[model samples]
Target chain A: METVLRDAAAASRGAPLRALTVRVGPLSGVVVDSLRFAFESLAPGGPAEGARLVVEETKPAFRCPDCGTLYETPVGDYHCPACDSVRGELVAGNEMELLSIEV
Target chain B: MCESCGCGETNPHLHEHGHGHDHAHGHDHGHDHGHGHVIPVRSSALALNQRLADQNRGWFRAKGWTVYNLLSSPGSGKTALLERTLAAVPGSAALVGDLQTERDADRLRASGAPAVQITTGETCHLDAHMVAHALDKLPADGIRRLFIENVGNLVCPASFDLGEKVRVVLLSVTEGEDKPLKYPVIFREADLVLVTKTDLAAAVGFDRDAALANIRQVAPRAAILDVSAKTGAGLDAWYRWIEAPAS
Candidate 1:
């Protein structure tokens, strides 16, 4: 979030930011609430102060290495639902991205 | 002054804003501000941490040091296990992290192993930069194994990669059998899971089978070991596992 804010501030030539959008995936291990709380606590009185934080969550998905099946269910268990193979690896939903910023 | 935002004010007034909405794509703004522009930025928040972690990994590899990251919740006996390991293993060093105090590092150093302490202040986890800084305080040569005892946090520590060769997550029997299920991300990323405090398993009514089942379900790839750091039970196997060459 800081990185995006800095980039936004740089692009806008130090203009006060209005809003920032971020994408948080399930496998990112970051709580949305905690991110919001940090932003609220830190963003005040800065270029990002009064800037709204928009969070978009992405659900985790796993792909079976053997059957090459992509499925999203029973997030804790990465086994493929079709073939029941335990060789499934995470293919998506590990992202923590700063998608955009409005300044 | 805020370096990133440059608010210029030392004590900037905080604003109480409403919870923002979740949008799949670009926001549809009904009110058009003449100066408002949407700038796209796709970047990971952990990018800086990861870059430092890669540097740490390269440095460790060049020095031929076998580094292990020990992570667990508070009171999982990480310090005790590290003490025993340092005492038993020759040419081993450690870097212990904590929110405050040098107690763990002091105890580990008492075992005759060169240990450094990293006080994270208010941070819940140790990043690669912190480890890199800690490495500067210790003699890097002649150390066969370097163990990093992370801050006693199961959640935040799981996300920060310290560039260790192996990540060992500890779960004491008293912490309950459902710990793996509750904190599955940590278990899934663990290279090895040590079920510690086995000496009090029966006394604490710990369900060994249930705990094993839960761990297997959540961390199918992680090598699980049951050990009692106090009684010296299973420490030999743990040592052997650590000493084994990376495959």
Candidate 2:
């Protein structure tokens, strides 16, 4: 993570880099709150440190077999709202994407 | 760490296979190993893929192409359906995903439909990132319909979103009608359901009503179509529904 930040800084050619925002999907296996905490802890006193960190938590998508409603599933618990099934389709959730590093 | 079992900590085998005790015949351990170190992987490996999927979704929307993801079990006629569809609708492109063979792409290409094969290296499902890579490699230029035929696995593919507008889960009539109820998640997530191999319906004793009921039970709002790629029976309805403006 630190190495990627340094590369981003170098690529910017010393221009001030702003917040590093990322999208964390539930199925992506990455915890959003924890990642944000780690970022704040790791980004201090570094070349790309001190910049604001933003982590966007993406809800895991679920589709109810009974209703076919495509909606987000809650973390840790795999339950379908429309059908009340413990199991359903996890359409999208697992994702940790570096959207962009704004300079 | 035990070379035979990969048990770094407790010897679970010792309790079962210890000494003269018939149940413990094979058990032998030198010391009481401590608990295994649990590493919390707080990072999502799919983040990069999801971002690319979002970008792909945006690209598809911008280009006004209706992206359809076709998923089914192997030999369920997903490629054959696409091949038939290409014959019906000219100028449509497809990105086919498979574990090994490029035979599907070759068949589609023979039908005058430009198709690309994405062979996943032992991966069960095709993720959004893979789809993005395949799209770049395939070059969907001047294409109206974009079909992403996912790897032939009903289980894993239901978990990943490949930035498609519609998820079409096909079930061949030859396959049991109870499949939808058994694999409810895939059926539930599908926006449309295509019941293939209708020509063999009677020969295989495939109950059409029971299958439709099972589908409705799993996905109440999904549009169900029974199509025979062999006879082209009900193919026009399938085509019109897919090409319809409302969809």
True contacts kept of each: 0.69, 0.06
**Per-residue error (Å), model 2, residue B52:** 1.9
The window of 10 residues in a row where model 1 chain A has the poorest summed lDDT is A4-13
B16-97: candidate 1 lDDT, tens digit per residue: 1112223343555543577667766665667666766887898899988899999999999999999999999998999999
Interface RMSD per candidate (angstroms): 7.3, 18.1
Kindly report which residue stretches of model 2 are placed more than 4 angstroms away from their true locations once superposed: A1-103, B1-46, B245-247
* TM-score for each of the candidates: 0.86, 0.61
TM-score of 1: 0.86
Q: RMSD of model 1, in Å? A: 6.8
- Top-TM-score candidate index: 1
Candidate 2 chain B: worst 10 consecutive residues by lDDT? B15-24
Q: How many residue pairs in model 1 have overlapping backbones?
A: 0
